[model samples]
Target: MSDDQSPEPQIFETLQPADLASRVADQVLRAIGDGRLRPGEKVADARLARELGTSRAPVREGLRLLESQGLIVSHPRRGFFVHAYDADELKEVYDLRECLELHAAEAAVARMTKADCARLEAQVQKLYDLADEGQTQEQVVQDFAFHRMLCELGGNSRILRLFDQIAAELRAGIALVGQLYDDPEEIARSHDPLIKALRARDPARLRAELHEHLQDAQIHVVQLFRTGAFDLTNLDKLSDDQRNRLLR
Candidate 1:
């Protein structure tokens, strides 16, 4: 191929839809999730295509998929940037998450099983493990997974679907926030009450525990947003220092 010539555009080879999305998101989206790509930073599709040794076609498609997930936002003329939710918007997101999650908890009590209880216990253990390891982002992701597991146990398809729909945004928020709590173990230990309530098969207790848990999170998010702890003013590449700032 001549230097002046454009390379042929290549299409993905017979990958399943989920597989295709995974391949597409493997690099750029992970960068966003892991904080390599900061919120409000621009995503250049052509650069991604070149780096991935593919065509721009699938890169754009992948970005569209993320846009649908609320991980990336698109502007008519400005293209795509990592989605940045204001404090008010994040509070609203948490409210919706809490609403559906409480319902999921209520439904899960009647359906709780030994296996389900065991799984929840394992997840809680994982949270503590991750916290001890000081993997802040990983632990936050696990926290979301624990809640998501509860929804799955609830066995309500629509409710689970809705929770998954908003989960990506919530995960991003929690992972990047600097001060969810002063101590990471505090975050892990907080889930114990809910698990206890679940094991007892006590609807009233489970609902109260779950509600208080989510409400405390909402309060912190609102306070963090007010304090401007996330440094939204700078939309540049995530540096080690900046990432460390949010890691605790």
Candidate 2:
């Protein structure tokens, strides 16, 4: 084709704000995981809209969703920025997790069905196979599923809501630690004891194992930060629309 007769690029339209926001949220969260969006960076609405090839409305909604998940923060007049977990925030998150998980364990013991436990066992088997196959990310996902199953078995809506909230925060940290460590065996070792305890239906041991697992994750997160594998400051670049979502 001649220079003056360039081929027309594909033009797709009909983007829905709610759906677009969800898509934006997923993309931004993954970007955060991969260190593209550093923690504490301002998220500009206009810039993000421009980058995503969409309008600011959906970006605002998406930012709101992420902010609610504790992934970002909004400031008056300034804009939205990535939210970082300080020492106290970190401790509180894990401590709450420990309490919720302990309660979940007790509930699981009292209410878990043969089928629920069987499904969990199947998850454990999948993790073992993934570990053996050396699929690190798949193993991490399965590991999360295993604990999520225990939480679901508890049969409590309040606990389920809290678990979902904490799980989102935990996933970011888990992904960071896994990338830094690059050791699936270590992850398996940590998970195996928890699985065994759950299998035995021993609430006491289950609680202890779950607590240990969170502690191990916390330590790994710190280690990753110290080694410069993860940085919180990268979020300073988020646009206002992104931050507003957090504050709202």
Candidate 3:
């Protein structure tokens, strides 16, 4: 461990332009996912380039990619900013999610096999474990993964692609209010009914369960908006109990 002792060589590999852009996009997305970059925050290309150890070109390319994904929006002269979360907009997004998921649920129930059910069950367990571990971001990801797997089980490429289109917004919505749930374990267990319906191969029951689940989420998000709990400035002023109850 002498000062002059040779250090382990770092592994370095060159990334193609597209790969670099994708990598930058992923880092920015991860920042958003973890709440480091909140809704409506400006994403300056030069600043992000400095932080990411690249140039403005790749950062601009990444911002363009994120813009296409509905995670960020560009203005005429204001550059790019994270997409703001609006209750009304979220309601519309949830409406679309419901339509897509209900259709997928029916189709999936008809075709789900033992192996598919097992994979879903494992995802549910991961959700529970992540909740207990207080890994809120990962929990949101696992929750969506469970539903995305359901859509995949339907064996419809187009429907899966459609889901992917809204995936970022969906994740953002969850990350925004994920800590507000009264009981994380209860939230994790909510998927049980859907899984049970899938196991029984009952499309009608599965559709009903899925609809109820999404409706509950919609209600919660709307309630949070109405209560003004997403105001980051006010959040710090709230009491511990209030904060936990509002954002958990």
Candidate 4:
């Protein structure tokens, strides 16, 4: 190698105004998680623009981003609406989730460091803390983060990407449908089994624990959809405080 060889010049394209779109998209997700937005509700981008203090273009783009992720849907002339989930749609998502995470858990146990296991333990403990406080929304976010780590630790780029693609819908679903149990600790403590399996470095146990956990969630979420629990909730009310709290 020639030390004096000229290096290729870095070419950078002008960045698009995607940050605003992403910010708007994040606020929309927060609102959905907060129960300010729900299934089958119209998403008025104009109102969101005023709430976000921007033009409608970015708001529309943001909703489009979510639509790509299956959280929002567009109608012919009626603007956008929150995607109304049913049992069948949920079944597909959960089935895919099981297929991915079970294998990911097996791979994770094979490659995870002690520090990695410790990090997982800390996250699980945080779930207990959040559950104790009865912060359902925060618990939903934390729960998603905990399971998302499985794919991250698994060290498979494709699996991680796929998980991310479905993540927006997954997070929204968890937030909207909520837990089946009145006892938050039940769901929080359920993760303990996964940690135990991981600590032992037993792939079979890890997969079994993860499978059962996901299966339980699948059953719970599908039942919620079947019973139309979320159909009547959060029809239309984007409060200033909710938007500000979410966006800011």
Candidate 5:
């Protein structure tokens, strides 16, 4: 076609109200989880509205929802700040993750269809591949993906929602602990039995394996605590170095 006869470019339309709200909230939550928005970082509604290209009304509504979910806190005059990163709070987050994730594992064993097992197997294989490749970042991502898939297979929205909320807080501590260890392989080994139990569809074995997984998670966090690395300020700062190392 001649230049003058070229087709016009397509233009995307606006997001649905529900989609817009969810997208805004997800962006903000991801920022907080990734340390881009550190604990105590002020969350200004006007700034959020501007950044998201939406009105302050929806931003305020999003903030209110996040606050109620315990992800953000609004001070009388200081506006909203990221919360739930204190040492004790991290402990609580991990504990809750353990409870829900263990149950999810059990449920998954009971409810796993062939297709669900296939997906779980695929995620498990990815974890193994990432481990073999020696890509620590990809290994961590796949590791979490395996667990997330298991939760999905559990067929329980209530449990999945609870796991989703706690995963970020749990990840903060895990990322913090990364600096003090060099044993991603050792960590990756934990997934084998969990996958095996799922393949067998044995809830008892799945529950046991999950308990062991969470125990190890707890131990890893405790090690970070002992190293004085899990402190909120230390975690936030060390994360900069961690990101740089991963990039290299």
Candidate 6:
């Protein structure tokens, strides 16, 4: 290949015409989740279209989809940028996540099978392996996958959909902030209680364990936000009601 030639984009020949925009959105969302794209980074539709081997129309549609999910922002006149991080937003998202995931835990506990438990256990093991290897990005993805597996086990399509809506943003937030735990092994082991609770099919225990898990993450991210480690320019853009929530 020539020095200036870009590598070929991943082909999407098998996808139906109707799903083109969604495929584009997923690719871009993965890029954000994996930290290939950074917060507040400009996303050029034309550039993305060329890279994805698609027309600009679908790329524009994809950007709009990401914007609605709180992963991208559209600035008037300038164009789309990755959404900047905010502590208040992170807290709110995690609060809602806790509610949804606790409910999911209850549902999953009631219906969870041996296979489901095995899948979750394997996922947790992969997280430990990734952390041991010092693969931060892969660790982030595995962490999200473990929770996503819980949501899937709950068997509520809508609940899983709702969880997925924030998946990209959650991954991006963790990626942008760097490491959340001092010891990667400690981070991997944190999920053990939840797994044990799931195996025993104890809703109460699962709920308690899940709550602590999310709360610890919330506390960590809030500390990072307060320390001025993340971008907060967008916080000023929020209205009084929004700001009040942040203060609370």
* Top TM-score hit: 5
Query: Each candidate: RMSD to true structure?
Result: 6.6, 7.2, 8.0, 13.0, 8.5, 8.9
Q: Candidate 5: deviation at residue 102, Å?
A: 1.6
Q: Provide TM-scores for the models.
A: 0.70, 0.68, 0.70, 0.69, 0.76, 0.72
18-136, model 1: which lDDT tens digit per residue? 44545776456556644667678988877666666667777788888888777788898888898877788888889998999999888988998899899999999998997889866
List per-prediction Cα lDDT, in the order shown: 0.74, 0.68, 0.74, 0.75, 0.69, 0.74
* Model 2, TM vs. native: 0.68
lDDT of 2 by residue, 1-248 (tens): 99899774422223445579988777777555545566677788777777777898888888899998888898889988888766556656767877887788778977877787778778877876877898765666666667767877888888977776665455445455446445666766666776687678888888887787778777766566555666444223334433322221
Arranged by TM-score with the best first, the candidates are: 5, 6, 3, 1, 4, 2
* lDDT string, candidate 4, 109-176, tens digits: 99999999999999999989988898665666677778889888999989988887666455435554
Q: Which portions of model 3 show Cα errors greater than 4 Å?
A: 1-24, 49-58, 125-141, 176-181, 231-248
Clashes of each: 0, 22, 1, 0, 0, 0
* Per-residue lDDT of model 3, residues 1-248, tens digit only: 89999975422223345577888887777666545567899888767776666778888998899998788999988899999867888778878888998998788877878898899999999989988997665566567678888888888889888887676566435544565576777768999998888888888888888999999988787667756665554333334433222221
TM-score quality measure for candidate 5: 0.76
Q: After superposition, how far is residue 130 of candidate 2 from its true place, in Å?
A: 1.6
Those runs of model 2 whose alpha carbons end farther than 4 Å from true positions after fitting are: 1-38, 47-69, 86-88, 177-183, 231-248
Minimal lDDT window, size 10, model 4: 8-17
Following a full C-alpha superposition, what root-mean-square deviation does model 3 have from the true structure? 8.0
2 or 5, greater by lDDT: 5
Off by over 4 Å in 5: 1-23, 177-181, 225-227, 230-248
Assess candidate 4 and give its TM-score to the true structure: 0.69
Candidate 5 weakest lDDT stretch, 10 residues: 239-248
Candidate 6, residue 237: the lDDT equals 37
